[model samples]
Target: MSGHLDYEINKELGECYLFMGELDKAEQYYTKAASSNGVHADPYLGLAAIAIHRGELEGALNMYQKAHKVDPTDKTHAGIALVLMEQGRGADAFGHFVEALKVNPENMVALFSLVRLGHELNRLDEVVPHLSRYLEIDPGKSEVRYSLAGCLVCLERKDEARAELNRVLEGNPDFEPAKELLAQL
Candidate 1:
């Protein structure tokens, strides 16, 4: 119980430091947290964040993978995918991002990264459903709606794209991209 408490306190401190952009302090606390409770993934995730901030992609990937091994949470998968993407392994990262989304459909990091990768991979068709799911949860997100519309346009489903763009314009009239897309459609 004491060890669990120690882990919790250290992990929280790590998160606070990370949020404050004190990467060194955060890493120290995260390391302590990991020592206190090896089963928890948060510490490794925090460590991975620090590694990424320091531009140590290999170390970040290792930490992320360690977290995933401890607990295959959405954050761990996303973190691993992010590091892999940075290492110019987008093809490999794509599967991990998809796994992250599957674990938590609302993971915006995984969702947005997948969208960006979809374009690079020319897998717009695969990204459409993920974008649609995100929009269902966050209907007010004009950017996500715009992305969905863009995907539809690329898929040669201009009618569907027009409908999505119209919805975006309805919610945010000043959205230039939506207006331009709507006009083009």
Candidate 2:
């Protein structure tokens, strides 16, 4: 069989084992897949996931870096950002999340993380645009709309915040948080 075919088979096996919670089996197949092909990032991503599951943060970071080097995709950037967040490197994680969003604007994980990190770091200005984009993609998410309203309130954009709160209340009339926020506004 061709090396690429072998790599695909090994990678599939690794994923199956990982899904079944067989870490050792998954690791073995993932390692085999990594050696089977020198170009694809899936094996490294799989290994990174295993490392994360095992609490080997440094190993997971290294594996994610390797995956990113191979394929600089949004998934790799998001993985690195998540690991950085776990390490308490919020600033660094924020940057990676931004990169992930730039690479794929529809990346909800990156968007949500960026919004959360932005709020925690008091960078509401940076978060507003992303939150708006998220709402565009998922208008039914009342909680996100509520969060956007809270961020707007912090920015003193009362009119915009009130609009968002109204939207949330319209979607879910019993959403007390939105009702409270609207009343405050």
Candidate 3:
């Protein structure tokens, strides 16, 4: 088989392990893939995700930066922003998240991170609008709906928030956060 095929297979296996919560196996395969190809970005991205899961934010940032340098994709930028946020650099993180969104406005990760950062900064107006845009992109995502409800509540839009919360509950009958908010309402 070709080296590129081996690299692709290894990268896929790495992603599978990462999604299955097996970071060690994921990292091993990603490293193998990256060393094999050194041309594709997926291996670097998989390694960065493993680093993030392992709480090695600096390593994750380095890997993600390399992925961005290799591919210049929105996913790479979003990954960097997420790790930066995990490292407690909220302001810097938000900037990269915005850049990722500007690169791909429908990036769910960037949108979700924006909502989180906006809320943390007490910028309810910004949060709600971002959530609204997220909804436009993926109206069926229950988590985004829940977040939108939270943003609405923060903005004192009680009725709209209640409606959104109800929508969340329609998908997940036992959604504790929505249940709690409904009780307060």
Candidate 4:
């Protein structure tokens, strides 16, 4: 069989096994795919996920880094950031998350992780523009707007926070948190 065909078959098998939670089988196929000279990062990404599931933080980080080096896609950046976060390196993860967001502003995982990290790092002010950008594309997301409101409140920008809460309440009148937050404002 051609190398490309072998890689595709192996990578597909790896994905299928990974989806079925057969980590050992998945790793075998992923390894085969990675060594087939296909120059693809899916195999390494699959390996990274397996390592993460097995509580192998260092291995996961290494695999994610390899995948990023192969192809620095938003997913690869997110993967690297997740491994860094798991290793208790929030400071290092922040930049990777930012890079992921830069590549795809609508990447929910990176956006939410960055928001959480911002709050943890006491950098709520820096998270506003990203939230705003997301909201611009999706206005009816009450949870996201609520999160933005919370950030604004922490930044002492009460007026803007109140406006955001009001918008959330407008979208879903039964949203108790928004109502409660607006009342507090």
lDDT, candidates in the order shown: 0.91, 0.91, 0.85, 0.92
In model 4, what are the clashing residue pairs, if there are any?
none
Please provide, for model 2 over 39-147, each residue's C-alpha lDDT reduced to its tens digit, 9 standing for 90 to 100.
Answer: 8899999999999999999999999999999999999999999999999999999989989987887787988888889878888898888778777888989888898
- Model 2 misplaced stretches (Cα beyond 4 Å): 174-176
Clashes of each: 0, 0, 0, 0
Error of 3 at 97 (Å): 2.8
Candidate 3 structure quality by residue, lDDT tens digits, 1-185:
99988988998899899999998998899999989945888888888877777778899899999889889888988998888898888888887887887788788889888988988877668657667776787787788898888888888999999999998888889889889988998
> For candidate 4, what is the TM-score?
0.96
- Name the better of 2 and 4 by lDDT: 4
Q: Kindly report which residue pairs in candidate 2 clash with one another.
A: none
Pairs in clash, predicted candidate 1: none
Steric clash count of candidate 1 = 0
The segments of candidate 3 whose C-alpha lies over 4 angstroms from its true place after superposition are: 9-29, 102-108, 162-185
Alpha-carbon shift of residue 64 in model 1 (angstroms): 0.7
RMSD (Å) of each candidate, 1 decimal: 1.7, 1.7, 3.6, 1.1
- Residue 173's C-alpha lDDT in candidate 2? 97
The reply for model 4, stretches above 4 Å from the true place, is: none
User: Once model 2 is optimally superposed onto the true structure by TM-score, how far is the C-alpha of residue 177 displaced, in angstroms?
Assistant: 3.5
Candidate 1 has an lDDT of 0.91
Worst 10 residues of 1 by lDDT: 36-45
Which candidate's TM-score is highest? 4
